[model samples]
Target: MLLGYLLEIVKDRDKAEEHLVSIFETIPQHIDRITGDGVNTWCELQRLARTYLAGTMYADTTSEAKFPNTANKFSALMNDEQHAVFCSIYYYGKTTAQLAQELGKTEDLIRKALREAFAIIRKAS
Candidate 1:
């Protein structure tokens, strides 16, 4: 699922597969921190994938291209808060803590917004 999602953004099969492999390799180190009591493992994995891809996707800072264009129909599906959370984390590559600081909100609230954004994206799909 993460590979498929990466494929859509990166638009390269080899790179996507490489990224998927990298994600798997790094998962073990993060497993303890990412998965805690009552924390949905799947959602945490998705969040990790998104964070990794945000770094990878924006590596070429000189490029004007972006993953989730505002004009895209999928972007239109998100409400204001969802879009803000999604764009900041995904497009701008901001972490939840950074977003919380910048937006004057709690880290928990940023996480909640991110989760809601993912829920909206899932519903759209």
Candidate 2:
């Protein structure tokens, strides 16, 4: 359960390590606080802490780095179709087929848009 939650929260390995450190350091104190309350409190504390850590990690990781200037350059170069496709895939988490249907295009066209968008972004980087 913890591993699955971590995977959702941490996009990369380095961020996962940082979050793990933060969680481990605080967990002992959290455990001690609920010790005398019995099994129910202990279990509740554990579950709460786990969920809290996942949210904390995601916020910290994403909020630290603003989009770079290169990202702006890449965005400026992208046409409307490319922008929509990229946003649907990354921000909205849509599958290629879903994006295609929403955009009234074929799946292959959506895939091409995604490929072109990434190529531009990669070049900018």
Candidate 3:
């Protein structure tokens, strides 16, 4: 399921392979901080792949006409911390706890960062 979803989003086989390699290397360390051994990482990957595909499809379909200049405006408005947190969670699949540990911040702080990042991204669209 995850492979199919990733293929849909990435389209190119080389890119999909690269994504898989990156995810495989990163997910274990990130997930280990939030979950004990025996967690189903494969399922988590599937969920992420599905989510990314859905979001990409939605944005591609709706954003062009709704907000023509949103990409540049939002990129300029995003704070470094917010962007880092967003990438850690969305692109690298880190949980709040994992992100907190990496940043030496509390879980609450990581969650706040994620919320702020999402708010900016949402407003841009």
Candidate 4:
């Protein structure tokens, strides 16, 4: 499922698989933290994957090179703010608290945005 999400962002099967590998590669180092009491394991893993993918997005050195095929069907359904929150969390690995501070909104509002964004994705899918 996570790979499916990444595929939509990168629009490259090989790169998406590579990103999946990168996420799994950190499992040994992050196992304790991810499996800590009260921690949501899946969410932690998703955050790790998103952070890794964000690095790729930011590090794409060719400024003139466009990211081709970026808008898959589901992504097209997202509004600007929904896209912003979704990308910040799922692509940029930002936490709700971090996004709240950055966007000058309450954490609750950030979370609500994320929830709504996910709902949009779900409906589109």
Candidate 5:
């Protein structure tokens, strides 16, 4: 499932496989942190995988690149900022800090945008 998720993000099986390898390489460190009450294993693993891929992900993006094929009605419902923030973290595997820096916003604002984006998704669903 993780590999499928990554493959959806990267649109490249080899890159997705590499990221999967890298994520699994460091999973031991995250396992304890994710093993708490109410923890969602799939969500936690996705977050961890995103973090590991964040640095490498943006390196592959071009300014003219279109929105990913994975974009759905949920994403279409977002405002531009919300879409950018959400897609960057949710698909491109960016951290809030990275998005904050890239967008010239504070971390709080980036987080807020992410929250708003999720809210939109939840509401639309």
Candidate 6:
């Protein structure tokens, strides 16, 4: 699951595998937080991976990032706006404010779209 998620983000098997190992290496430091009650482990790990990659491959912002196909399972359930909000925030480590500015949307609306996106993902799960 982690590798699949990483693949969706990095789109390179070698890089994703290398990142998976790097992410796993930090697991011990985050074990307690990761084991918390009601925590979505996959989401947390993905968050960590995003943070990790943000400092590495994603650090150079010269080129724009690419999103997964909108028809991918989770995103297909969302409207175009929701998918954009979710992918920018979730996959690219963008904050709601950043997305709002980039999308020319109000922060509250971006947040609402993010909420709806999460609801769709949770329902799919």
Best-fitting candidate, scored by lDDT: 6
Q: After superposition, how far is residue 13 of candidate 5 from its true place, in Å?
A: 3.1
Task: Give each model a TM-score.
Answer: 0.55, 0.44, 0.47, 0.60, 0.71, 0.80
Question: What TM-score would candidate 3 get against the native?
Answer: 0.47
- lDDT of candidates 1 onward, in order: 0.72, 0.59, 0.58, 0.71, 0.78, 0.80
Q: Could you tell which candidate, 1 or 2, scores higher by TM-score?
A: 1
> Which residue pairs show collisions in model 5?
none
Candidate 6's C-alpha runs over 4 A off are 59-65, 122-125
Residue-by-residue lDDT tens digits, candidate 6, 1-125? 88887787777889889989999999999998787899988778878888887887654332234676534678888887888888877777888887788878899999999999989999998
**Candidate 1, residues 72-112: lDDT per residue as tens digits?**
56667777766777776665467788778877899999899
User: 1-28, model 3: which lDDT tens digit per residue?
Assistant: 4444444345666877766666566556
Off by over 4 Å in 4: 58-78, 94-112, 115-125
Better of 2 and 5 by TM-score: 5
Q: Summarize candidate 2's per-residue lDDT along 1-125 as a digit string, tens digits.
A: 33333443454557656655676667677676556645576455545545565355233222213212222466678887887776545433457877677778999999998899999999888
Per-residue lDDT over 3-120 for candidate 5, one digit per residue giving the tens place of the 0 to 100 score: 8788867788998898899889898888887776899988899888777766774445424254466646787788888888887777766678877888899999999999999999
**Candidate 6 residue pairs in clash (backbone atoms < 3 Å):** none
Give the Å shift of residue 42 in candidate 4.
1.0
lDDT of model 6, residue 43: 77
Give residue 86's error in model 5 in angstroms.
0.8
